[model samples]
Target: MNHLRLFLLSIVVLTSANMLPAGDWPHWRGPNDLGAAEPGQSPPAEFSDTQNVLWKTPVPGRGHSSPTIIGDKVFLTTADVAAQTQSVLCFDRQTGKPVWSTIVNTGGLPREIHSHNTHATPTVACDAQQLFVVFNNHESAQLAALDLNGKILWKKQGPFSPEQYKFGYGPSPLLYDDLVIVAAEYEKGYIVALNKKNGDVAWKIDRPQISFSSPVVANIAGRDQMLISGLGKVCSFDPKSGKQLWAVDGPAIATCGTLVWQGDTVFASGGYPEKETMAVKADGSGKVLWRQGVRCYEQSLVAADGYVYAVSDDGIGYCWNAETGEEMWKKRLGGSVSSSPTLVGDLIYLFNERGKCFVFKTNPEKFELVAENQLGDEAYASPSFCDGKMFMRTADSTDGTRRETLYCIGE
Candidate 1:
């Protein structure tokens, strides 16, 4: 089904229970934006090009952004260096066919980016009515809202210049009720929340530091606060008021991983000038529950039960008690891993840079590998799940002639 038809059908079936369907990955991680797949739906443990692979389609340009799914359509962003264009692509969730591709920006870049980072590093977010995308257009960052049919509803410019981040931008927009919050952490940091209806500035907070970590919202102490880590601190802000509730100083500097929230505690890790992993109280007390030397600079940690799991950039998987910071188990999964693991039921799905997909049990007792499968030549972008299907993006060939592909695995 096309996007327009799906939107119309959704309006007719719009009930309290069906507002956000169980099988819609509306954001970077998933519906909850916490790297959790839909319940009762299991993607295959083993899949390859010819085994359990539903479909494989060629993506047009280079993108480190992951796929976002809403109802019957999947959304992703890509940038073509030669053409100097950045685009938002929509594909049919079932058929793996192209639905529409909308160019959101044109012209060359304003500054040089890191070799590993692309201009389209940020992932898109979606709500019931529209899709929100962030593009670093030349000097200014642009946030746009588009209908399901690829029509632009509104567009607003962010607060920072691209040149501020010498490396590049990697933060994705966080969508709450009727606001889309974007973080621009350069030499000077600012969190801007735009009105989703008409793209006006709703609230903005200024923090002077460089960061690449994305913000996540969690309910703690009967309030919803947005969490972001960088510049020697992990701060919590009132999502509705944009007021700083509390800030904890640490050894953080330019963090890449997002925080993992479980119950009344949240775990955060950062890499670069400093290496530290910490679990902090989430009740606005600014108390550090525990601190450790373990770090996941690039990939985010996943918390389940009473434990948290993280795969370092060098491919070492560590499971620790979420509250005590004691190590439960540590094992090595070969090859570098930048993609965060997705938790489904009791199994954790981890993909390495070499395209090796590792399925293991999220056991706090020991490291248990259930299955290992190879999918592509290289994959840095994380996977998304919806309706029992898994979507992955792979870009092979480090040279200019890169072959970017999107794969759908199921059954």
Candidate 2:
């Protein structure tokens, strides 16, 4: 396998995402950035709170960020809304116990975020020796690095408060080579790369216009490139040097899901103002193969083989021929969906907003429903997989009280 992942992440645009024997899910979209774990592991096809669950731990606070597993430790970011603080949480992967918690931001919480949004929304990313996390606290995006034991290594902030659209920050920090990259797309936004060692500015660029998508790095069209879609454009940049390789007019002006690619074609989807899904060639020729009206708002799409699969924001599942943008099949999985589809071998795991877990085959011929499992009544965050378990973040909002729990689901 490619040794490229001791860890891969976005907070997620994870093209920098997914992993193996390293057996860790240290990034958002996973080590491969494709929302798929390394193929050998067996995370249960049907699992619930008591069934197929090896362990479960109550998370201290709430955040939509996914779990990031590295070594024996699992990491997540949370914010105490009443306390106005944001912190990094560590958990024991074996017994589902609390390991340590480090407070990263104490105050400066934004006055108004969307009712559905939280102060801590980015997944923590690590590069072997250190753990890195991002939070939209005190009106700016703060990036912090901590040692494996929860000691703060360094913390840096980039201004990101927008005047009109303040939905709160969502992009996770992306790691490439020696730098950690972050995209804070407000009206006056930027994509900045910082030195992982001391959090210094390596290179920075202005991402005007405002888009909420995370930046992901992938090797497509024969070269390593960083990709993100928003601000009325689909763009590729040189990951090492921060140079614009190529950019084309986009599928829309605002997008939340990270871009996913297959073969030489890059796929990007929805956001505010307009909604559409598109496939663009990544050869710097800026050719757009096809465009569709399907929108996947807060969740990213997964591209595999020659086909792409997605669960639309409205609770519908879709399979499209990646090469031709042909709609092979789309099934209504029901309820709303905020979590992305996770591909484990030929089986794909999907979770709807109401906490419905759907497992299905990747056969493009039709919608193949394998199994359906239900967890908490509310699930907004995505799941992370490693070894033989699935780390699922779910919550119970019954009786109007919200409590979040992280469940380790396995065979």
Candidate 3:
């Protein structure tokens, strides 16, 4: 079905009991946004080089961005380091066949970035009518809207050039209402929203200081508020008007994970010069309830049933009391973690840097490890769960030639 017809149709007819309709992961943190997929999907938690693999397709180039699944098409952005090009790839959702690739930027790829960061690190966000992506090319942030057939409809440059830091961009495009928002958080940073139809600028705000976090819009404290951490604070913005709702200090000056919430309180954690995880009241009160010295950094937090769950960089899974900042449980999972956790009903799927996935339950009482699935030698992209299957971007090196593959896990 086309996006217009899907929008006109009743959501009751489209959505499942507790998930977005169509089981499409439209953006960075999936459809419902808090890194969770549609419940009741029992995609195999165990898979290897051969076991339980539905279809395996080779992906060109490299990126840390996760897969964005919409309809029968899966979308991702990749950059050829040698060619200095950034492009988007489309794959047939069922057969794992390459549909089309559109290069958004050629040449002028930033020279210096963290070894783990990429020119095409941001995940594409698609609406009913267009696909939106951002790339840090030409030493600035470029936003583009593409059609489903891999055609660039419009590309515009936003104000972003980190003279001091130069870490590259990490925030994925956030689709809210009719706007596709993008954040580039250097000292002369900006959070801008553009019209999804024609790529017209809607609203823009300046942010000082540098950070790598993504902007997330959630309905918390009884209303819709946009949350992003960094620039030395946990900040909230009105997604509609580009107004600052509130900001609280601490959670460090640099972060990568998007903000997650439980009830009226939202949790944020980060890495940089310091480490801290904080719970802030989201009712425009600028009140911070609790904080812990532990950090999640690149991995975002998932909270449910009055508890927040996170995996540390040193390979440990932890659950904390959501309201009281009490440590509930911690289990060492081994290896470093970078991928954010995705929750499917009671189960949360977490991937470490070594491409080992730890399947565990979302219980606050104790650490519950369900299964451990290993796929490749390295992985930084989080898995996208959709339609009873998993779209994972993994890589294995053979004789120093690293090959990336997009694997459809489970039957």
Candidate 4:
């Protein structure tokens, strides 16, 4: 009987391996939503425009949205400013050639956005069957589901004007089971969970304050909770019912990074209005473990090996003890970072606005630099890894050109 049990377990493991393979950045922050790469996939530690790069494809228009890879296809969103159109694009994962392009929305403006924000700023998400995209066109917002072949499955829109915020909208959709959840928080912001199969609204809630932070789902103890941080509150909701679970005071007037979870504790940081970081209990207790002045505005926090790592917007890197909130180490990485770090094995890959990719070891004892490489232009989006390749979206040109390009880097 024991021999038979082992045999069945081996079959299940083998079958699952063949189905998912070693790499697939199906979510904006990798499959696990923690920005960690799959095990045993050692992407190149250093690469430039002419180094280890497998392919470089030119993407039309401009956007800071990160690339999402699933199976053999890579998905991204972009906006053609002159034409007044926002689009969802899919490309062949291996060859970097355009597979298909579909426009999600066209024309609809009267709102001025931040110089750094774009209409196509949100990253796309994909489940097993369809790809999801979100866009806010000044007066309203729309969420659409597309088939793997680029056909629209269903699209839904709601009233959302970001003119009051001045920075525009930049949050992405979260795919939770059969629901595509989105948080559109500006003046009079709200959260919506849509039926993934038919684009129907499953649940909705109003947010008291405005923020740009994306929502994240974390399983604590034994229950799954959806966490949304911004509007000066750290709130958890029922992903299935859209019911509010609990709320705590978050320090930021505007936040762009999602909460990072470790054990039963969750960590959040705010950059605008205030530079603060807080670790709170996730059991709806509203208990604060520790709060500090360390601010990581744009980049998200990464927790590993009992330490939470962060790189501030202006280049200050930090490693804090996740439990005690004690500072482990800090160093200036030397460039502005709007992109979050991706953890692969023992190393963390951090991209700066100047196109420099900084690789370092994730250690609590000290700061150690591994390697630094350039993409030959500006890179505002985070890096995505699949199999053995690193996909990065960079500015069209280093000389201030307006186009955007997605580059695939590997051995």
Best by lDDT: 2
Cα lDDT computed for each candidate against the true fold? 0.82, 0.86, 0.85, 0.83
Score every model by TM-score.
Answer: 0.93, 0.95, 0.94, 0.93
Off by over 4 Å in 2: 1-21
Model 2 TM-score relative to the real fold: 0.95
lDDT of 2 by residue, 1-411 (tens): 122221232222333332232578878888777888775666789988789989999998789889999888999989998888899999998998999999998989988877767888888888768899998876789999999999999999989898888778888899888899999987788999999999999999998777778898988887999999999889999988889999998778889899998878999998778889999999999899999898888899987667899988998999999989999998998998988899876788889888889999888899999899999988888889888789999988887988999999987
Q: What's the lDDT of the predicted structure labeled candidate 4?
A: 0.83
lDDT of 1 by residue, 204-270 (tens): 8886777888898876666788998888888899988799999897637778888878778888898
Choose the strongest candidate by TM-score: 2
Displacement of residue 352 (Cα, Å) in model 4 is 0.8
Which residue pairs collide, candidate 1? none
Model 2 local distance difference test score: 0.86
Per-residue C-alpha lDDT of model 4 across residues 1-411, encoded as one tens digit per residue = 134433432342233311334467776677667777765568899899889989999998888899999888999998887899999999999999999999988898435888778888889888757888888874777899999899998888887776456677788889887889998887777999999999888999998566888898877745888997787878888888989889899768889997878778989998678889999999888999888897788779888777899998889899989989999899999988899999877789999988899999887899999999988568889999877789999874646665677899999
Candidate 3 ranges with C-alpha deviation above 4 Å: 1-20
lDDT for model 3 comes to 0.85
Ranking by TM-score: 2, 3, 4, 1
